[model samples]
Target: MTSLDDLPLRDDLRGLTPYGAPQAPLPVALNVNENTHPVPDDVAAQILDDVAAALREVNRYPDREFTRLREGFAAYLGHGLRPEQIWAGNGSNEVLQHVLQAFAGPGRTAFGFAPTYSMYPLLSQGTGARWIAGTRDDDFRITAEDAAAQVAVADPDVVFLCAPNNPTGTPLGLDVIEAVYEVARGVVIVDEAYQEFAPKAAPSALTLLEGRPRLAVSRTMSKAFAFAGARVGYLAADPVFIDALRLVRLPYHLSALTQAAATAALRNSATMLRMVDEIVVQRDRITAGLAELGYLPHESWSNFVLFGGVDDPRATWQALYDRGVLIRDVGIPGHLRVSAGTEAETTAFLDAMASVGSAA
Candidate 1:
């Protein structure tokens, strides 16, 4: 049996742990922030048909450009985006990895507000770039002034901004994004993986893409589209910025089946996103439910809630687990996060929380 110590691993990765959430077969699984709803049957049928059709040419390499999928993404995103401005990969993680590989590696640095997405630092280190963690406002929010000051100081080659941040579910204002872009001389990425679940009237970072060649807004199908298993993520940026990713991507990185499935999902974007409205309702319900239980539920624009005031997050997490309901202990000393699931699943989680008593 060989251990990691016996292998010639990169010095930077020697003591680093891989990123992942605990996976269990618990009955009411709400960890990992996945869309807990199933894909609509009609959409699933269409995707299956598209995948089957693609199988006919499986012997050949997939469309190297994934042209139709890019067009589909442009259409879905619709800030007058064109296909040339779109790029995608296995998941948003890969999409961000491409950005780091193209802009930040060995000797260069990547920066993000601390307690943002866990993957930002991981992706930076994996690309051989140094990770610089900056501070956020008191309640996990980012202010324009603070953001500008931090970026000006770090002057990193890459910056990641998680809109409606994970772990704490705090929303990011466009002012802060514009502020960071104005100060940072490097590529600035706005990860909007949970954007579809945000308030409908909120403007996306895509709205700021024009003329800001260094800014990129990335999105994922894993949340609102119920396509997590399909693993499709994409971003909108200047055509030239999209071009830079081409230098680092592996040939035929996306398979024909994946391209087909994601395109089909995009074509039925309306139906695929119907689940978001219901998920929002559940997210609010969880917030209200937590408040009634004497916990501090943060304001969330995404399909999950991160609450504080837990005396022991691990104990509450385990108690919920024992009752067959699972949530995330996102490493915030007094906080835990849980995804908004189907109505019944949400009820189960709340009921389990009530039984655990108030840890506030």
Candidate 2:
């Protein structure tokens, strides 16, 4: 029999498990960290109208510059970070790759905290940069001083900090990020993929861009904007780095339809903000409810909570799945991360936890 082994897959990726999101047949689902709200029917229709208007020009190539979407995203985020300084791509994941390609390569080091967004390590390996993960203390907390110390000690070429961190949902506050910025000898990336759900006490790292030329803040339409399938995300960095991203990304990466849909959603920023307020409420409510149930989940500034200190993490994950709930089973000893859904969904998960408190 002929083998497909000759096909060009990266040598390093040979041992990796394919990433498949577990979608179950259930009314109340909470797996991926997605905003519970779908785009309002009216809003979606309006976006289609806008996209259709632009579709007429599909005969020509898309705007390689992506000017409209870049400006629209900055206005929607309304960050002090300038639109001119923002760069868009297929997803924040792609934008991250651009950063890696620009700064990390063979003989370079990319350091990130353990239990971060899973993509960081994969990208590091794929880009031929060595990946270094620092272990966090018991509370899943790291001061900027602590991170800064790691940078000085490890001497990584680039660093990734996931604020309101993935899986753990621990928010990195401004003071901590500030200290890291002050001490970082290399480029520091603050990945705020879940920032819309972060508590006010957790300020975005974008505020530090002026003083830190080696800083980049990544954002995504996938989470708060409910555009995961749209594949639109961006990063705000110093103009020099943003230009580097422009030079690195394939020309006209974002299709015309995507630009129009993204722009339409951004114009109605109030809708996204309203959804964000609702999601934050749900996240807090779920965290508190989990605590009351004898499970110690992190008090998150993101859209999910991490349940830890379990005995057999594998068995616990299986029980939840058997009961028709799907959650991300991640990281080392005694922990599993689940996202926040509706109030009912959160309750169902808690009830399931009570059902299988014994992770045997």
Candidate 3:
């Protein structure tokens, strides 16, 4: 077996670990912020039929442009978007990488607020762009002033804003997003992977796309659409920006099966997404349960909750795991994050937490 050290590898990636959370396959799995609900039977049936149809054309290459998928995505977004203004990839990570490859390179830089999505910096570094980890306030919130100030100081070639951020599960204000765009000399990517789970009144940066050519808002079907296994993530941006991504993405990047499944899922969007409100209900239940257990839960607009005040987060995590409940120890001191699972799974997690006595 050739060891990694024996093989020729990029010097920058020599000692870096790959990105992933633990997948222990416990009874109550709530670690990765996945939609716990299975694809509803009706939607699953449609997806199977669509995929079977595509299988008949497996010998042919997928639509190089994924034309119908783009059209379906545009209709789903419904903010006057056109197919030309939409782009997609296997996942949002790939979409972000495409954006970075087109805009940021060896001499350029990308900046993101710390404790946001862990993958932002990794993606930037992979593109050979300098990565700047900016700071947020004590509550893990970024204000418009702080964002603009950071952009003005760093002068980065790209900025990433993870709305309803992961690990912390806090939503960024539209003001902060627009403020960063005003000051950023390069592209601004707003990641809205969990937007569907956010409160009904929460504003999306999608509304700010009118005159901002540098702005891009990315979304995923993994969470709300219950299509994580389908690997379809997309972005809505100016036609110019979308065209630039075409230059960097691989030819026929999305597979025919993926395109068929994702398109079918979007066609039945209402049926596939019916669990969103229920998930939100479970998220609130988890938040309230955490508070009752004497933990300080962050205000979350996403499906997961990040809470603090654990004497030993690792030990508490282990305790929960011992009871067959697997949550995420996101490396935040005294903090842990758990995704909203099905009602039974949620109850199991809460029971495990109660058993562990995770009070401050």
Candidate 4:
């Protein structure tokens, strides 16, 4: 067999590991920050019908523009967005790739604060863009002034702001976004995959999109809509920005089935969102439970919680896994992340943590 070392590969990817979270089977799995709740029955049935209809037409190519899907997404967003301002791909990762391909490539650079979505750097690397890991405060918060300073220093071609950021679950304030935007010389991408799980008052960068052609806010149906299997993710941006993504996306990138399923899910957006409150409740429960167990839980506006104070994060993760519960270590030193699941699942996770003894 030819060893990988014997084959010619891109120099940048010769020794790189793929981006993925552990997918170990466990009785209570809270890793990956997936929406634990399955799609509701009624919505599932509707999606089934839509997808079946789409399958019949699979002999032909899917709508290249995904016009109806874009319209559905715009309607679901309801911020007076037009379909022309929307762009989507198989997932938010692909959507981000489109943006990076369009704006940050070759000699350009992409900058983001550390402890953010792990994929940002990887996406930049794939595009041959220099990835700059900027700094965040000790509490994982990025203040407006600090953000502005970093942007000024990096002067990157693309800036990524992960609101309700992964690993840390810290939501960025509008001030921080505005400050970064003011100093950024090129595109600013805001990843809002978990925005629906945030508090109602949490500011969306979409509100900041009126005149900022440089701004793009990406959203996903995977989290709050419980449609991860559909692989639908989108962004709201200026039409000019959206147009640039068209140049990078593959032809018929989204299959007919995917567009149909995601469109149906968006049409039933109200039903999909009904689960947010319950997930938020479970998230708070996990936070409080971790704190009571002597762990330091970070404030989270997303559907997951990141807590620290573990003497050995890997050991704690293993201990919980031993008891049939699974959560993410997130490579954050002493911290780990656990997504909010059903109430019963949350209880199981908490019980498992208690059995393992916290902060040890």
Candidate 5:
């Protein structure tokens, strides 16, 4: 039998080993930063009823453009954005790919800071674009001057900013975002996957929306909104830029069920707000606990955090798993990222951490 192995792999992907098994379960699972709280029975019932009504929304297909969901999202964010300014995909991860495909490829460049989502450069390279990354200072924040210098040279076609950046959870300085937008000849995507946990004064690219046509903000319901299983993510960009996504992104990319469920959640933003408050409260508690054990996590505005040890992070991860607590090995060499869970589970995790640290 002939095999396709002879067929050449994509040139850019010839030699990279992807992260293995992101779903492997541990005794106290805290790896993915998923919302520890599931939708309550009331929310679940509403979701079911709304979905039943919306299932007949159109036998033909969902609004190929997802206009209502977009409008609802814009209103939910109170960003005054219109349907034309919005785009949705199965997840924010896909939206990241859409931006890279539309803006960066061939000889073009896509750039983001290192120790970020870790998915950005992978997506960029997949698009056949040259991917470049600059490291943040030890404090885990990137500055406007340093980022501006890279944009001046790389002149990236797409710049991904995971505000309150992943793993590190430190938001990029607002000035850095503005500088990238001001200088980049191409689009700048602000991946605000964890904005709810960020301080109110933390900088965001959303402020430059009107004057900066190339600016885009990608938001996910998976984090603060507690809609991970629903798999809904949206982008807020200039009307024209968001529309450009239509050219490359799949039509009806959002499911009727997902749209129904997510639309309902956003309609009742108060629930999400309440959940975020709980998660934030728990995050602080967990951070404080971790610190007490000499486990210093970088300042965070996200559901999870980054902490390092004097040893291999992967080993620390395996050690925790061996003890029945699952956490993330953030590929930071000697660091792991721990997400928040229920209060009881959090206590178990703290105990697990104490045991692991003591043993190490």
Candidate 6:
């Protein structure tokens, strides 16, 4: 039998693992920060109609520029954004990959605060760019001054800031984005995959794009719109910054059906996003419940909660899994992260935690 060792693989990727979370057919699954709510029936009907229409042109290549989809995203983002400022891919990971390919390659470097979205370093290395992991303040917070100093020292060709960071659920401030951009020489990416779940009045890095061509804010429909299965993610940036991505993307990268469905979803953005308000309710419920159970739950602007003080994360994870409830361990010592599911699913998770006892 052949194995990886017997094949000729790139030495840089020799020991690296592909990014993924655990998969299971659990009764209550809250891992991976997915929006567990199903797409609204009315919106789903519209998407079906659009996708069916698109199928008639399946034999032809999709719009290489994806113009209409770009326009849809620009309208949805709505901070005076225009189609010229938008770029998208099958998912936000691919969107970020384009940035890496355009700006950072072998000999150049990419930087992100430590314990960020696990995919940051992986995407950087996959592009042959060296990945520099910088330190974070206590509880995984990054201060503007500290972030700027670290970026200056690393001198990377790209920087990834996971707004409302994953695994820890720590929110990034606008000050940090401004500070990093002032000191960093490279393109700065703010991955706001969960931004729709943030407070309504919270400012986004998109607001910083007007004067900073080097800054980009990426978003995805997977979380708030319940369109993860549709594989649509986009970004808002300066027109010139968007042009850089054009140089690296393949011709007709997005499929006609994908563009159709995403555009339809965007048209119904108001209805689809109503789920976010409900999810936030469950998120706060989880936070309050975790604290009552004697666990320390981090304040989350996103749709998940990362709770600490678990004595044996693996054991507790197994216990919850045994009860048909699955959450993420996220490799943080004494910590676990769980997404905000529908009300009933959230109840099941909290009940499972209570029954399992606080291992701490």
lDDT of each: 0.94, 0.80, 0.92, 0.92, 0.80, 0.92
- Clashes per candidate, residues 3 or more apart or on different chains: 0, 0, 0, 0, 1, 0
Which tens-of-lDDT digit does each residue in 226-327 have in candidate 6? 988888888999899889999999999999999999999999999998999999999999999999999999889898999999999999999999999999
Off by over 4 Å in 6: none
- Sum up the clashes in candidate 2: 0
Top candidate, metric lDDT? 1
lDDT of 4: 0.92
Q: Lowest-scoring 10 consecutive residues by lDDT in candidate 3?
A: 11-20
Q: Which stretches of candidate 5 lie over 4 Å from their true place?
A: 1-4, 19-21, 201-203, 358-360
Candidate 1: give the clashing pairs: none
- Model 2: residues with Cα > 4 Å off, grouped in runs: 1-10, 357-360
TM-score of each: 0.99, 0.93, 0.98, 0.98, 0.94, 0.99
Stretches of candidate 1 above 4 Å error?
none
Q: Which tens-of-lDDT digit does each residue in 95-133 have in candidate 1?
A: 999999999999999999988889899999999999999
Give the C-alpha miss distance for residue 68 in model 3, angstroms: 0.9
What lDDT is reached at residue 27 by model 4? 85
TM-score: the better of candidates 3 and 5:
3
Candidate 2 residue 27 Cα shift, in angstroms, is: 4.0
lDDT of 2 by residue, 98-123 (tens): 89988887889999888788889888
Candidate 4 to truth, TM: 0.98
State the local distance difference test value for candidate 2.
0.80
In model 3, what lDDT does residue 233 have? Answer: 94
